[model samples]
Target: MPYVVTRSCCADASCVLACPVNCIHPAPGEPGFGTAEMLYVDPRTCVDCGACTTACPVDALKPHTKLGEGELPFLELNAGYYRRNPHADRTPMYVVPRRRSVPEGELSVAVVGAGPAGMFAADELLRHPGVSVTVHDRLPTPYGLARAGVAPDHQDTKQVTRLFGAIESQPGFRYRLGVEVGTDLTHADLLAEHHAVLYAVGAATDRRLGIEGEDLRGSVSATDFVGWYNGHPDRAHDDHPLDTERAVVIGNGNVALDVARILTADPGTLARTDISDRALAALRAGRVREVVLLGRRGPAQAAFTVPELLALSALKDVDVLVEGWPDGLDPDTSEKTRLLADLAARTPAGGRRRIVLRFLTSPVRLTGDTSVRALEITPTELYEDEDGTVRARPTGGDTQTLETGLVLRSVGYRARPVPGLPFDEASATVPHEHGRVGPGVYVAGWIKRGPTGFIGTNKTCAQETVASLLDDFAAGRLTGPARVVRTRTQALDLDAWRAIDRAERAAGEAQGRPRVKFTDAESLLGAARAARTART
Candidate 1:
């Protein structure tokens, strides 16, 4: 049987390079590679060599025969790509690029984030001889979003951190966790000791609804909700209201679906995962029974990816329903449309909890005296732009009110302005040319690209940034001392972070969980300090 790419594919494209048959569609330079939801395998060309299985960090590749009932859709999804976009030439194998060599002297670089992008950039730089990397993050723990942003139930996706752990183990890799770039160490401070500084800080803020009553007590951003449940230090103490029978999410992207799924998921199932204690406890006691995901656009233009939709559809003991589905939406329009049509056609299983996918609805205003009581929304009409982009325009008729205690704004994420770097406010990103901001200054990941693409997407993004930095270094454009730099901030080193990691894992093992996280900075720091004291 041919190997099939499953839902967990991270789009890192490692399997594309490993495949001897060169069957994977949308390789790095190929069309649609950048925007592809997940990499698909061309079943006709796959040789069943099993190389991709080993190359995939998340184990997303599996034989077609071994697919479970829920995973059988991916086989067609993989084969369907070829039906739509067939490759005429498949003879040439993908060649690995030659490793570039740097100057003879030691090259010290500082990466100003511990996210996937920063880690990937550091890994790429360390490929050259005489190069050293010091990663700095404001948080005490490393793996920014990979540790805190990913949904707790999706542990397979989190496995990418193991690959990051290997990168951390590489010689010359160093960490200065809990040190903020602009506050703790100035950009000039980093440049003074390192040959170049690469900023991979991700998008930190969520886009606002800009509607009236948005500041109501029960209203919150999905970003905070995700972080709260995932144990992000910034949102660990956040208390989201869950006393209502229904909660409404304002967007239909994967994050929206994630929040909806988590809200309606079985608390017992979440207990086995690494969800924060506070969130788990709240969920167990909460009365939320239904989550309504509101999409401004129709099913054809829904923002949630197919993989995420499939996962949400497969939720055990959860009834997935579609509301406000347009009258003439053709099920044959796309895979997403087809899946949504199937969902709309399903008979309600009378599951314990429910998730409603409501389309073509735009929130007009939040209604309440002190807290959110109802959401007023208007129907939208879809139209295609000159650039072939689908957009929704509100129709000023028959506005409906949804009664709910909680409202989550899940429009999207925006990159915050870095203190010392130039930023583009309109785009919410750092202005750059091929990841180059200025001489010896560079950027990578969401901060550079404006919060787009998947976790593995950062691999290629970091590679491009590192390439530009290396080019500048090779041409004598970069100027900095090779000496070590010291900071007064009491940052957590690699050993300190490892100590906290061990403590979390040991605690989780006792409770039959993956890892029980320390939700707050105080607890994390205490754990690290306790570990150090024990060693002493």
Candidate 2:
């Protein structure tokens, strides 16, 4: 049997290079690689040598026979890709891009944001012999979404940080944590110290639903809700009320599924994960039993990827149900629709906790007093345009009221305007031509493209930005700094970050869980300082 790519696939394409038979479809340069949900292994050609498994950062590859009940679906998912989209005339091996020659004299780059995009860009730049990178972030810790945005239970997904750690170990890489680029050190200041400044600052704000009573006390954005559970320092102190029997989440994206899963998952199971202590306690004490996810369109137009939906179906002791599924919808339309059709056919296991996948619905208003008490939702009708595009509009029928105390808005995310950077209001992104904003100024990640694609999609995005920066440097468009720039903010260095890491691990070891994250700036800094004092 061949190896199968599972849900945890990060789409970094590292495994694509390791396959001796070149069985992985949609290699880096191939079509759909950037937007693919997960890379699939061609079972027919796979030698089962496990080379791809060794190269995978997230351990997303598994032997076919060793697959668990939950992972068995992926076997067909991988093979189905080959059946639907065969790659017969493709190159036998991936053609590696020619390495660009390093420009004369040493080159320095300032990468703003220690997230995946910034780290990937830094890694790309450091490939050149004479390149050096200084990464800066507002947080004391690094790995923005990987650490704080990924759900705690998905430990496999979190393993990508190990790759980031390897990038940090590179000789020319350094971090200036706790320093905000626009505020603490201006873009001009960085330009004076480095040859170029690359902004990987991701979308920082959640898109709001323009409805009545959205500002009620019990209502919150899924971004903040995920942050609260994931130990994000900014949301560490946030209070989420879960004292109701049913909680309503508005939206059908992957983040919506994440918050719903976390809300309904058994507290005993969550305790073993790296969830914030406060969130775990609140969940244990809360009375929430059912989470209803509202989708404005039908199953065909659902925004979440198939992998996330599969994970939702596999949750232990939780019943996944489909509500308000439209009539005449074909079950064979797509994998997601087929799965939903199967879910709609199943009998509920009568589990105490359940997640309702409600379709063809839109929240017209959030009915509440000072706090969220109920939600008024309207049915929606989906229509197809001449261009084959599907959209939803209110049906103008009777509205139903759902009594719930908590309402999480998971509509989407938008990029906030960075100080001193030109932003396009319509797209909520920085204005740039192929990642170039101006001379010595560039952008990557969600800030470059709008918030779309998977985590590894940023790799190709960063590679393009780095290529542009290198081309400018080779053409003498970049000028060396006139003077050295200095900042008075006390920034955390590599050693300090390592110290915090050690402390978190040690504390988690005592609790028989993964590392207990420091959810506040003071505790993180204190751990670093204590370690520094001990060395002295």
Candidate 3:
């Protein structure tokens, strides 16, 4: 049976390494690898060695025969991408070279943020002998978005945590959780104690709609909504009033699809998922029946990934409808555009819940007195510039008002400035050239390049930053660790995290779920302490 990539694929691309025939589309170094929504196994070329199944961090690879009814759609979903070009050129499987160890003396690096970037950096740094890595994150949780931002229903994507766990289990690797670098310890402290410090803190804030009435009670960002559902301690208690019968989401990105899916999904269906208990309860009590995802551009410019759109379309009782198709559609298309056209061609089944995908519309204002009551949108025109770039221009001829109680802006994400780091206001990123911010200081991931690309994108990003740091060390630009006293911070290490992980899994076991997460610092830290005591 051919193996298929499923909804939970984190896009980490580990499966590509195990594929002997390079059957997976968009493997690293390939043309579209960076932007691909998910790596696809070419069924036509798949040897069914089951190598990818073992290599996948999220266990996203599954044989056709063993897939559940809900998962069977992915088999076709994977195949459909290749249907257009079945005989696409294939290359030898790319092999990541083993990193050579640092020469001269002992190397100790501090990586801030335990997200994909930081974890991958640590893994790369550890490949060198006589090197040790210490990771730090402000939150009690180890992984950032991988733990708190991924949709709970995507259990497979969440499995990338296992890869991180493996990295953490490596010798000379440690993490300090619940410790804010700038607040708890100065940047100089880390610089003093380590040869270098790599900042991998990802883009944390969402781009705002910046429209009138945006501050209305029901106006929320997709970032918070994702965080809330994934049991992010900071947003778990948010009062996301899902009291609206119909909601308007501004943007056509994957995040917008995620929000629409969460809003319209049956709460009973979410119960078995790893969604937060409070979020589950709120969703169950919610009356939301319809969601309209608005895109300021045409279907050709829609920002959502094809896989996400496929998942949205596959929703059992939810209708996926599209509006605003241009009379003469452009012949030029991408995989995303082709899938969107297919969705537009299909008729809705008149399901109880609906997700309407509207194109060439931009939300001009949020209309309401107390809470969001409606969204005023202006129609847009798409034009190609001399450079062949498609741009959206607002047209005044038509305006529409959507009676939506809730409005979610899912435009994009911005990296917040770290207190002690040099930042570029224009890009909302740390000032860096090839990941090196300064001597003995570097950056990786979204904070370094602004939020773009998939999770595996960070691995390449981290590799670049590490290469720079290693070059600096080899050049003797970084002399040595400063001779300064380091203050002790009450932080949790990998063991503490494992303890908390076990406790959460134990708690989830009784609930018949994957894991019941601790959504607060107190409970999470307390569990860690208890685990530490037990270990002693």
Candidate 4:
């Protein structure tokens, strides 16, 4: 039986490397690699080695024989991918080149943000023998988004942390937890101490709806909600009012789906996952039974990926209801369009909890006396722009109001400007030419290109940034740390983080979960200090 890539897959492409036969299509640098929602295995080229199962960080792959009911659709999904992309080159195995070590003298680099991008950049830098890398994150814990941004139920995706752990164990790799670059150490300070500074600091804020009553008591950003449920220190104590029976999410992206699923999903099911105890308790006590996702465009133009829609469709406990598919909307033209059309075709299962995917509707204002008690939305019409792009235009005739106490906006994320770095207001990204922001200054990930693409997308991003940095180094550009500034706070290293990891795992072992993270810097540092004391 062939292994199938499933809904949880984030397209990390780890399995692509592990496959000896190179049956996996659209590997990095291959055509269609960037746009693919998820990688698929060719059932025709079957060899049941099961190497993919171990490599997949999200447990995205499963043998056809052992496919569960929820995952069964993936079998057909995987097969259909090959059928659709018959012309795709699957014969040639793409082998990653071995990185050569630096010839002489130590090269020390500082990477800000311990998320996927920063970690991957550090991993790349560590490949060179004479390179020493230090990662700095404001949060107490490393693996920024891997720890807090990824959904709690996606434990398999969290498995990427193990790989990061291996990178951490490598000689010359270090980290500074609870250290903000601008506040704690200036860019000049980092430049003074390291050959270069690569900022992978991710987008910390969300795009706003900009409608009235956005600051209402019940309104929250998906970023904050995701962070809260995943034990982000800043959002651990967020007071999200979940007393309403019906809620509205003002976007149809994967994050919106994630928030809707979490709200409607049985708290008991979430309890088994790594969801924070506080958020779990809130969910358990929540009265929300219906979540309505509002999309300004039609189903075909949804920003959500096909895998997320498939996962949403398979939720056993929640009924997914699709509303407002415009008549004569043409045939299924793309994979995402096909999946969305399929969603439109399914009859609601009439489950107690429901998630409504409302299309062609745009929010105008949130009306309430003191807080959000109702949402005013207007119908929108689709029109082709001069550039042949389909765009949504507000019809301005019909207006509908939905009574919902809670509103979570999931429009998108915007990169916050670093204090000392050059910023581009248009893209909300640091201005750079091929990842080189300035002399001996670099960037990668969301901060470099705005918040977009999957986790594996960062691998290429970091590679490009590192390539530019290395090119500069060869030209004798990066000379050493420019200046060293003494700071009151100590920068935590890998050993200290390992101690924290051990402590968290031990705590989880007692609690019967993967890991019980220390939410705040104070607690995390306390654990690290205690671990250090024990070691001494």
Candidate 5:
């Protein structure tokens, strides 16, 4: 049997390098590796050496027979990607040689976020065998979205963090938890202590609904909505005030589908998953029915992926209605008609939550006094300019008001300017040339690029940033350390983190789950410190 790559696979493709027998195809240097949704392991060539499992940064690789219920879909998913192309080229396995000599100059570096991007950057730097890394995060927990943003049913994807845990466990790496770079310590201060600073703080903020009544009670941003349901440390105990029966979601992305699915999912079915206690409680009490996902353009302009669309269409007992396609939409849509056809046909009749795809419509204004009452929608036309740019034009044909209680804006993600850093407000990112944003400072993740690509995309981004920082250090651009340790910041080392991980796993097993996260700064720190006493 072949090893399976789980759902939470962030598309890092680190396993391709680790597999000794060259079983995994499209290695990082290949043309398809960058854009491919996830890596594929060739079952025919596998010697079952288990090296891929050991080298995986986020424990995505699992022996075929050991696959759990949630992981079974990935086996088919990985294999299916390969069926489209025959005779795909394969290469020798990647080997990281141990370096005997160390680079001279200020080699210590600091990474502000410990997400996949930061960890991958650190992992790449560690390959140098000299760079000392100190990772910092605002939350008590380290991995940003891997532990928070990803859905709970995506446990296999979450496993990638275990590989990150192993990298963090390596010597010369330090984790400073509960630390906000700009708030807790100044950029200049971090620069003084380390040769350079790489800001890997992923886009934690959400884009907004520019329409009126956006501040109403039921209005939510998909960023916060994802965090709330996924047990983010900040929202673990918070009450979700979703009193709306009818919901309207703005935008058409994977996150938009996630919010709709969770809101429409059966609370009893979700109880078995690792949903936050607070979100689960709110879901149990909520009486939501119809969920309308609004897209301003036609079906050909949807931002959602084909697989994600298929997943949403396959949802059990969910009524999915498409406004434009009911009369038989064109099969070859600039908008992926194949995905649209799947969505139109697969919905179960008389489903509990109705998913209405409202296309050719734009939100002009929001309605209601206390909570959102309805949306004022105007008909729009997809305009293709001479240069092939798509624009939305008002058709002046129909205007409708949609009655709803909740409005979620999933337009996109925006990168926030770290205070005191030079921010390009228009792009919502730091201006940089090959990861070198400025002297003594660098950027990674969404802050480097404008909320583009999956979690693993950050690895190359982080590598670019670290490489620049290392280049500056070698050139004698950085100064010596100062007596400015960010006091409020507390980072847990690998040893302390392992203790916390064990405790959480044990706690989760007791509750008949894989692992129950601590979900807060106090509890995580308490859990980590508890390990010291118990070990003593």
Candidate 6:
């Protein structure tokens, strides 16, 4: 009856930190833990305390008896991580790295957007012992993308926020959720109050394919799709566009794999994870099977991490196909290459869910009338430069058509500028060095740097930002914003957060489930406000 790892797990390894007996594998900070799909509960060692369940934001963990029928496969997936080595104790939860310290009254700072970058920056800054931090966000819930943007099956990744939650409850840090700085308050106001403001707003939108049939009913940006399924208040109420039999994803990155895995996963399997009820219902009725993922370059040039490729290829019933490996490169048996080759080798001998990995091919057009009915593509050629970088160009008169109903654009994410700050549209980042963008302005996260790197990469980045901020504090450079603090929320708050958490758990209990999330913001905020009044 051990709960299994479903398709949506992003290996953040939070459960490893929460588990009392340390039953979870690839613990946080472990080598492979960062890339793992989800944390697994060791059935033999699990005392079934359910501590991990409460700690999970996406609700990926469950008691063995609590797993729904479709999630039964995960039990095996969780157990499989230990197959090769019985004593592989990687992924241990490590200590927070050395924290930066500053003078008492000089330690005040304002950080916009409660996403991973903001949270990590705050976590690093709190090490100063006396610094007080005010974290601002547009949504009622904290832990920005960690709670809203990550895929639903990545419950363990979401669990990292339990650490954030613990941080939220910390004495010096103040989370002002549902407050947008530019709107509710201004940069001037924050500067008046604190020494500096760090904008960690993240890359909130998707890069368009900019081709035909992009706005069609079936086509969806994996960004929007992931947001909708993971209960982003903005998209939670909107109808999902993923009603199709065949899906074409135009990138080979991790996000593309997430969409492909979700599209090909068993609806029953998804129901067990924290996938939105609306998405689950749509999936139950949708026609998606084969998702053809297109890559503009060859395997070596791929932007996706080696592990994500393996995770996508390793699904039970789904088969992954790689069209071309680099011409002269001898394939190594490294886990990623081996898994990728296995994916290529397992493609149905010719038929499966058909995650066709096409290299050096660019989308010429998406052919369809009312909605997408097919796609037009042109074959591309690649040449290596003296720098060893491969470049791709289309071959003339080599156009082909692939009949499909859905197209997903999974190019990289572009970080957005904080509304009031100076933005370099080309870079989408607030210009900064060592965290100081201006006299009282600074930035962090995807907005500070374009969307790149893994979660751990942010720590060093955040540390660097804090170091610069501290240096400015020592120099008496950063000033406070213009306005005074006005504490009024436009929407959700902590009491409301409690109510939302309660409602989700209550729903899970009513249906003999673990915990079910509220898909829309209205319900969450409404419940949150009600809870606030009740507490008062």
RMSD to native, candidate 3? 2.4
Summing lDDT over every window of 10 consecutive residues in candidate 5, give the lowest-scoring window: 97-106
TM-score of 4: 0.95
| TM-score between model 6 and native | 0.79
- Model 4 C-alpha lDDT per residue in residues 1-536, reported as the tens digit of each score: 47888764556567888887778766876687755778888887859899988887667788888887877878878888888876445564656656756854468899999999999999888877788888998876898888898888778678888888888888888778778888888887888898889999989999998888999888889999999999899998788888999999999998999899999988877877788888999999999989999999988889998778888888887878888787787646766667666767877767489999999999999988888899999999899999999889898878999999999999999998987898998899999999999778999999998888888778878878998998898788887765666655786766678788888888888878887877777778888787668778
The residue ranges of model 4 lying beyond 4 angstroms of the native Cα positions read 8-13, 88-90, 94-98, 349-351, 482-484
TM-score of each: 0.97, 0.98, 0.93, 0.95, 0.87, 0.79
Per-residue lDDT tens digits of candidate 3, residues 1-536? 38998753556567887788889877675666666667788888899889898987777788998887667768777887788646467765767676667653478888999999899899888877778888999887888888887888777777888888889988889888889888888788898988999999999999997899999999999898889899898899998778889988899888888888988888888888889999999998999999998888888788877667777777788888889886688534666666677778877777489999999888889888898888899888889999999988898767788887888889999999987789898899998989999988999999999988876678878878988988888788885777643435688877788888998899888988989999988899888898679778
Q: What digit string (tens of lDDT, one per residue) describes model 5 on residues 345-396?
A: 6645773678888787788888788877888888888878999987777888
Model 6 residue 135 CA deviation (Å) reads 1.2
Would you list the rank order by TM-score, best first?
2, 1, 4, 3, 5, 6
Please give the lDDT score at residue 189 for candidate 2.
94
lDDT of 2 by residue, 1-536 (tens): 57998884668778988888889978876898877888999988888899999998778888999888888888888888899989885456765765776754468899999998998999899888878899999999999999999999888888989989999999888989999877788888998998899999999899999999999999999999999999999998899888999999999999999998999888988898999999999999999999999999999889999889888887768899998878898899999899889888988989569999999999989887799999999999989888989988898999999999999999888999888899999999999988999879999999999999877888889988998998898888887877777666888888889999999999999998988999988899999897678779
Segments in model 2 whose C-alpha atoms lie over 4 Å from true places: 103-105
Better of 1 and 6 by lDDT: 1
For each candidate, what is the lDDT?
Answer: 0.89, 0.89, 0.84, 0.84, 0.75, 0.71
lDDT of 1 by residue, 128-199 (tens): 877989999999999989999989998988998999999999888999999987777788889888888999
Spell out the clash pairs found in candidate 2: none
RMSD of each: 1.6, 1.4, 2.4, 1.9, 3.6, 6.3
| Two-way TM-score contest, 2 vs 4, winner | 2
- Each candidate structure's count of clashing pairs: 0, 0, 1, 7, 9, 24
lDDT score of residue 168 within candidate 2: 96
